[model samples]
Target: MQPTKTNIFLYLVAILVNLLSFSIGVSITWITSVIPKVDGSTITDDNPFGRLLTASEISWIAGFLPLGAAIGPLAVGKISDKIGRKKSLLILGCVNILSLVITVFAKQTVLFYISRFLAGVVLGSSYSVIPVFMAEISENHNRGALGCSVGIFVAIGMNFALVAGPYLSISVYSLLCISPLLIFVPGFFILSPETPWYLAARNDEKRLTKSLLKLRNKTVEEIHLEMTSILEVVVENETAAKAGVRDLCTNNTLRKSLLICLVIICLQQCGGIAAVLIYMPKIFEAAKTNLAPEICAIIVGVFQVFGTIVSSVVVDRLGRRILLLVSSVFTCLTLVTLGLYFRLNLSDVVWLSWLPLFSLVVYIFTFNVGLGPVPWVVMSELFPSNFTSIAAALTSSTCFMNTFIVTVTFPYLSTFLGMANCFFLFTVVTICGAIFIYMVLPETKGKSLQEIQKLLGSCG
Candidate 1:
């Protein structure tokens, strides 16, 4: 990799671009705090409607975001392809700002529903486009590290929402959530350059040279060689047949890449992180822990951010497959242990009141380091350039769809099966994920985009 000092501009761009992720993280967990306040319970002092929202209505409120997100990637993928990543993101930021403004003024559930669904559209679009943008701008050696930074910003946003949501009124919290996009929209537009790949694909040599000058620290000779390589890939894509869902399924290399992406994304969501995060405060309340539910959620969120920091530092060093395997195994163990703790609670094991907090801290930390972030990095690396945008959309939409199912069903599942049983079920799913990772995933660490495609192409 280039020396750390030379990559400062690149890192800055990564940080600015990922502020979109920060907003997404806040949207995911904001409902947890808001639900109690609006449920017409003792907490009705903060209720906007001064009336009870039925459990079904509340579930829809929480579900709408992911539901909208599940639909966003399909449309946004095409938008990014047609308009380019930078412009697509700018549009998303404007839309996000508008949605949050609506949210601040919303007194009716319908308005909240509309605002959240719009936010989800932004969420899905960001996930679809951000990885491609990051991958295109990054150097081969640092791509994993930079791509994994998505989880860091997301964790920070989730932590911010958890810590701030309880203290602020709904309007105040909603307005505060708008701050990231306000910063991101202007900052990214002014400071960040378009990816060299996008410019090269359009044969815009003048702009492509300028973008590379901003993004690369290499000498002119090296930049020329890199530009040649990019142009070659663009030519190859230009000559290749158009790819679609049907084409993706029939092509061997693309099919394997897509299957890998789908499996990891499904595993990522099915491991129950989304449900855990969305219901964290409720989980603590249900566990009857000594610490306040909000406090426990905040603590776990802090650990989550820490874990992503660790992942960013070590990802390129430790490699992707190993971290994923270790994360999956340990995450499985934590969930199984957590399930056991809840099950044994029937016997009055108040002595282990701290177990849930300890278990969750480790769970969140482990999840972030590997399963949380590495899958996104791997997804970005696995696909060919021609297929990147559409493949990313398919993967992201599937991811959010799984998230929607898990988040919407968690309450009902916990009520019917008990939290212990629910966790046990998650443990089983995680174990299967671990096996899949070991048996199927190829190591992509330190590989170039071309090299990764070759590796996937060679896979039987």
Candidate 2:
């Protein structure tokens, strides 16, 4: 396809929105580097806080973000509907800025908890809004790649945190995290246009036309045809007067989409990703690797970024189902091997020590290729525009809740069930998730949103 002015602009907007995901990535992983510093026994006199934090305090600080994140989607979803997606995102970007400022100046443990919670709120709202915005603005042929940008940006952010956090002081790291938002906020406000779908839904004819003109490089006739299709759905949705939980339950197609989304998101979180990312340093510490723990964590982040880039490149061509199936199968095998390695390590197997780091790298890679990115991409594609904000909120909430549960409990689970058993459980979940994907999960490549609805409606 020949590139047009509109195509170039669309790519630019996609990159801008994905930057929000990158900022979120930094916020989410910031604690990973900071925790070991605060949790250590020696509270150096130069430390800003000038006190060592208790394990319980550190746990609460780490866990509070997901808890706050779970609430963010519920509130931000409705807000995004009232205000446009672009403005809602801008507001959330400011919220992230505020949270970072709090992190920089925080002297008390409660302040740290509050800052983390605020970061979680930003995460929830960003995940809820950005995917829908990207989906709405993108052409069908390239929507999958555009949607997968969330994962790519997130990987970038995580990589930044892993690489930078250990080297900088807490205040300096917090400042660095805020640097991206400075560009994202004003840049999005000044450069980006509101999504045509959102404008059409509000019945703003002049602005809608302008948006469609800016977003598409087609002839006037083609633009009219595209606008007509969007307006038709908007008019149909208007009769229902705003989608809610009732709509989700009463509409069979919507309900089916929700089921598929919920399952995919649950599997994504419950498959042990959040725990693995949060505890990566510790895992490296225990694995008997010659590399430093920070270096291992950075390596894992690199693999994650690589995997997401691969997904973004191939998702449009190979489609969602195939990649997800591949991800699930390899993830299961890696986890199983990791479990067995840990099990055998207890009996003095010297050669198996390298397996944990190797398994973790492969597992992170496999998870990012599909389970990490595809679920959110699918979530954005699955729901109608009218229902997307609310549906995504509920789905994002479920994801954060599961993350909270997994992150907070993983240590205890490791202590009680043993790390070997923990991996075994994750292995089983991955197998079940792969089976679920095989049985369900229709291919969404190159399908318009309305076409997707019809496709789901036809499925038994």
Clashing pairs in 2: none
- Tens-place lDDT per residue, model 2, 1-460, is 7888988988888788877899999977888899778867688532567888876787778898888888899999999989999999999999999999998888888898889899999898788888899888988888899888889999999999999998888898999999889999988898888998899889987888878777786767779988888899989877855588998988888889999999888899889988899888877776677778898899989999999999999999999999999999999999898788777773245666566778889999989999999999999988888899999999999999998998888888988998889999998888888889999899988888988888998994
Cand. 1 TM to true fold: 0.97
Q: Which parts of model 2 have CA positions greater than 4 angstroms off?
A: 45-47, 217-219, 240-242, 346-348
Clashes of each: 0, 0
Candidate 1 off by > 4 Å: 1-6, 217-219
lDDT of 2 at 254: 87
Q: Each candidate: RMSD to true structure?
A: 1.5, 1.5
Every model's TM-score: 0.97, 0.97
lDDT (Cα, 0-100) at 166 in candidate 1: 83
lDDT (Cα, tens digit) per residue for candidate 1, span 1-460: 5455449889889989989889888888888778767764554657887788887888888888898889999999988888899999999889989988997888899998898899888888888899899999998888988898998998898899999998888999999999999999999999988899888878999999888887876666768999999999877866875758887899888888899899989999999998898888788877788998889989999999999999989999999999999999889989998899878883256887888898999999999989998998998998777788999999999999998898889889999999999999999899988888999999998998988878887885
Query: Scored by Cα lDDT, where does model 1 land?
Result: 0.88
